[model samples]
Structure formats: structure tokens, C-alpha cells
Target: MTTTPAVRILAIGGSTRPQSSSELALNVAAMAAQAAGAEVISITGRALMFPIYDTETTHRDPLALDFVEKVRTAHGILIASPGYHGGISGMMKNALDYIEDLREHDPSYLDGRSVGCISVAYGWQATVSTLHQLRQVVHALRGWPTPLGGTVNASVTKFDADGSCQDTGAAEQLAIIGRQVVEFAQMRQASTDATAPSANSGS
Candidate 1:
């Protein structure tokens, strides 16, 4: 019989700006995930002491090491980033580079894991691109990206001062994505548990 693992979701906001749109989007997503019965942890990429990824320091960054450990233990992930020049911001991209350590430490860090992406941008053009890029990054990690990976246009003023999305329509969509991620992660976890061999039962 399949049993579900406790669904632990880790969310990262791409930008570290004081009033970053990425962080705002992540908070909204986190609220929706909490409503869906998942245990969620939010990381600002600020806690870690990672250095910029360079060929020389790639293997020895403490922050990178810490991040890999965190992701390897989580059942699911949600990422929100801001668009910068038609791509993701430098901080988000740098944080993602830390995932490289996981490939060696746990080649399956993302395998069978569920992931969702959200992006906030000044305009729609960069929003979609940033979201797409985030999804691609998750895919490369071997994680399954949810169908509703999102894009939010900050210009719409859809988000409130507290980083909550105030617009009903946009909020609903983001919530749906969060719910989908939790549902998918739970199912995947259950399936993995069911497939593992029992220690006492070779019968």
C-alpha cells in the first residue's frame, strides 16, 4: 500500500530586493500551499553564505553546500523570480547554480519531485520568459514542473503592500498552481514509498 511522505515544500524568491516582486509572489504561493495542507519553508537566499559561482570556487561554497542539503530533503519546491532583461535576476540564477552540487551528491534530487514556478515582472513580455526559464531550470534538476507554472505582471498592482496578491483572478490562478504542486508531490511520495522494498518482507 502506498503511504504519503510528509509533504515538505521549499520556496525561493529570486530577487533579494527590499520590496522585490519575486518575494511577494512567493508569499502568495506559500499561503495557497499552506491552505492545501502542505508544510512549507521559505528561503530568501539570504541565509546562505554562498559566493558567486566561478570555476575556481564551484566545489567549495558553504552556501551552495547548505542549499543542496535542504533541497535533497524536501519533497517539493516552489520558485518565484523577477524578470531582468528578459531573464531571471542575478540572485535567483546564482541561487540556482547551487543546485549543481546536488547533481553529484544526489543525482535524483529532483527525480520524481514536484516543482512549481512563478515570476513577477514589470511587463508581460519578460514575465513569461522568466517563468519559462525557471521551469527549465527545475526540469534540468529532474523535477516535474507543474502545469500551472506562473507569471505575474507587477505593473497591474495586483499585489498588495504586504506582498499578497489582491486581484482575485490572479490570486486564484497562483493558488491553483500551489495546490497542484502539493497534490502532485503527495502522490509522488506515496508512489515512491510503495515501491521501496520492505526490510522484513522478502516473502
Candidate 2:
């Protein structure tokens, strides 16, 4: 019997401060994706530090290049952001900007991938707004946003340093997103496989 490769998931987000609530939430979602049988690669916290995206510069930073490569190869993605003043944090936005490097890739910027979005904020307003923004960005990138995006109010749902969630309800939402991403990617892959001409068919 032949074995199929595990789905690759690129998990990115989190604040500059290590182990922040946003990162913890991302971890929860990533873990859930893993449980759903995906291989997750996470780029968070300080690892996300990159120069502000400059469309004029042809030169790419080494770290940014590696990030782009990961994005290029990922079959699915999870993006979590901390809502800052009713928007995504500058750092997180900057990292996302790096996706521009993938414009010429076969599928282009996040195209045909399932993206799971999570937004963490101190209040419902920021959480909802940030989640909406994430979905919009994903759409612009040509990625499909999972139906169940997570909106985590940092003031209400707290996380332990070990990446455990205090609120069961919020935790379930995060897990659901992760699972949805993997499931959608699998379905997309199946569809593609079905549509492709069979190797045995004449050219």
C-alpha cells in the first residue's frame, strides 16, 4: 500500500513579544491542525521580524526569502493576529506583506489554499474588526477563508504560558478553524486530482 504525504500547513502570526496571547492562540490552532493530520510549520514572534515590505526593492532579506519559500510550499495556512487599535498589528501586517514575493508562483499569492484566520483583541470590537480584515486580505490573496474564523477576546479568554486556553468555548473555535483548514485543503487537493488528465491517457 502507498502512503500519502501529510498536508503541509504554514502557521504564521503573533506579537513581537514572545508567548503573547495571540501566539498562544495560534499554537492552539496549529496543534489542532496537527491533530487533524497535517504537518505544521509555524513562524511567529521574533521570527516574524522583517523589514517593512518595499515594492521598490528587488533585494529580499534572507529570513523573508525562507518565509516566502514556506508559503510557497504550504498546502494550507493559519494566520493569527493581535488586534491593535481595531486593526492588525504593524509587525503582523509587515510579515504578511512578504507574500508579495510569491506573486509569480504557480498558484500565485496564497491562491487555491485554505486559510484559517484568528484574531485576538481585548474587546469584541477589535476581534471582530481584525477577523474581518484577515478574511479580506485572504480573499485579496486569492485564498479561501474558512467559514469558521475565530474571534478571541483577550480580556475574556486567557491562555496559560503552556499554550492552554482558559475558555473552553474559545478553545473549541480555534480547534475548529484548524481542522477546517486541513479539511478544505484536502478537498481542494482531491478536486484537483480528479480534474487532472490521467497519466495513462494519451497526450
Candidate 3:
């Protein structure tokens, strides 16, 4: 009997400030992914600190390399970005640019991976626009965007330092995003395994 390996779901993004609401939101989503039985990898705070992406240069800082490797092997992804100027924060966007490194991988740039996107901002406009931009980026990466994306309005909602979300609706929505990513990843993995050749098959 062969048991499938646990799905790896990489969660990335958050504001540069430590323990910001955006980061807390990301944590909530990751927790849900864990509860759903996927192993979660987080790239937040200083872990997301890297030099600007340069397509002309092959040289990459250690942080950039690490981010690329995680994305390369992840079965699913969750990204929670702080909304800046009605779009994603520069820090988060820079980290996302590193995904170009996966273009040479066997599956190529997030292909067949499910991505859950979240946007935390002070206003509805920023949150909604940021979420829209994130979904567009997921499509561009060849990843499937979960049916439900989380748009958290910080003006009306708050995440406590103790990792508790003040808004029940927001918390539930974020969890749904996480669960959906895991579910999609599981389905895709099962499909791939079913089509794989048996070890005992003769050439």
C-alpha cells in the first residue's frame, strides 16, 4: 500500500512590520491549512526581505534562492499581501517576482498548483483591488486561484497579537481559502499518482 505524501502549502507575504495585521491574517490562513492536513511553509517578516528581482542577473541572494526553492516544490500556495496604493505591497510583489526561477522546473511556474490569495487593507477599495491583482498574478503564474479569496478590511476588522481575528466572518473566509487550496492540491496529486506507471510494469 502506497500512501500519498502530505501536500506542501507555502504561505508568503505580510507587511514589513513585525506582527502586522497582514501577517496575522496570513498566520490564520496557514493554521487552517495545517488543520486540513497540509504541511505549511511560511515566508514572512524578514524572511521576505530580499533584493529587488533582476531578470538579467543569474546571481541571487540567499533569501531569494530560498523563496524560489520553496515555490518550486510546493503543491499549493497561500499569499496574504498588505495592500499598498490599491495593489500589493512592494515587498510582497518582489518576493513573487522570484517565482520566475521556477520557469525551468519540470512543471514550470506554479503549473497545476492551487493558490489562495488574501488582501488586508484599511479600506474596501484597496482590499478588493489588491485581491483582484493577486488573482491576476496567480493566473499569470499558471496556478489555480481558489474559488474564495479573502479581502480583509482593516478599518472594520482587527487581528490581535495573540493570533485571534476579531471578525468572525473574515476569519471563516480566510480559513475557507486555506482549505480550498489543500483540497485542490489533494485532487491534483491524486490525479497525477493515478496516471503514474507502476514500478512492477515491464518495459
Candidate 4:
């Protein structure tokens, strides 16, 4: 008998502020992933605040260790970034840099995983710029970015305390991003299974 493992998704991003707009957006996307039948683990906001990543050593704070472990185990990822000066936020960048710790792992830094990118910024330019930068970073890490990335313009679109989006269209876009991550993850898993040697082969 063969049992398929549950898909585990790691949702990362947000600013230092608790319940920041980016974090709220992350939660919205994560809920969408849940609705897609994937189990989601969120590491956002203050939890993402880690010491600058140092390539010189492997020592990490407990939270940083937990963060890296989650990244190591996740089959998919959702990232919601708050644009900082037209690029990724310092804290979030530091958090991502920790993925380097998985350089020697079997998957080797998001290899064969799908990443859904979302950017929340006060303006359109920063939002789009951050989204592009984020996708580039994911590619550099060997992860596939989902086809539909989300850009939430904070000026026009608002997220409430309960993770509700003021704009219906934006909400649906975030949902699509979330679903795309799971969809791609399933595809990758299927491809891997198809290519693997069967149990009865060579018997």
C-alpha cells in the first residue's frame, strides 16, 4: 500500500510590525492554500525578525532554526512582502537569506517547490517592483514562482483586522496565487512519482 504525504506549505513574509498589512495579506493567501487542501504553517511579522544572516557561521537563534526547518520541510511556499523603497524589506530579506542553510540538503533550497508571491505596498510601483524582485529571488533559490503573483496596492486595497480584503478582485487574485502554489506542488509531485522507478520494476 502506498500513502501520499500531505502537502505542507510555509507562508513567510511581513514587516516588523505585528498584524502589518503584509502579514494580513499572508493570512488571506494562507487561508486560500488551506481551502486547496494543503496544510499551512505561517511564519510572519515579529517571528520573521531575525538577526542578519551571516554566511560565516551556522549558529542560529531558536526562531531562526525553526524558520529554516520549516523551509526545509515545506513542499510549497507563499510570500507576502511589504515593499521597502521598491525592494524587499530588510527583515524579510534577512529571513529568506537563512534558506541558504539548506544548501546541502536533498532538495537544496526550495528545489522542486512552488512559491506564490504577493506584494503589498502603498503604491503600484513599489508593489510591482517588490513582486518582481521576490520572484527573482525565488528563482535564484531554485524554486518555481507561480504564474499569477499578487500586488496589493495599499492605497486602494485594504485588509481588515480579520483578514478581509476591501477589494473583492484583489481578494480573488490572492486566492488564485495561493491555489496556484498548491496546484504546482501537486504537479511536481505527480511528475516525480511518474519518473521514479516502480516497486515492481526489475523484480
Best prediction by TM-score: 3
Error (Å) of candidate 1 at residue 139 is 1.9
How well does candidate 3 score on lDDT at residue 73? 88
lDDT for position 96 in model 4: 85
Stretches > 4 Å off in candidate 3: none
From the highest TM-score down, the ranking of the candidates is: 3, 2, 4, 1
lDDT of 1: 0.79
lDDT of each: 0.79, 0.93, 0.92, 0.91
Backbone clashes in model 3, listed as residue pairs: none
TM-score of model 1 (CA atoms): 0.89
Encode model 4's per-residue lDDT on 40-93: one tens digit a residue: 999988888888998888778999999999999898999999999999999988
Count of steric clashes across candidates, in order: 0, 0, 0, 0
Q: Which stretches of candidate 1 lie over 4 Å from their true place?
A: 1-5, 107-109
lDDT per residue for candidate 1 within 1-203, as digits (tens), equals 75444699888775656777777778778788888888998887465336776656546666666677778888888888889999988878877777766666544658777888988899999999988898988888788999898888989846677777778787887888888889998887777778878777976
Candidate 3 residues 25-135, lDDT tens each? 988999999999999999897789799999999999998998899999899999999999999999888888889888888899989999999999999999999999999
TM-score of each prediction: 0.89, 0.96, 0.98, 0.94
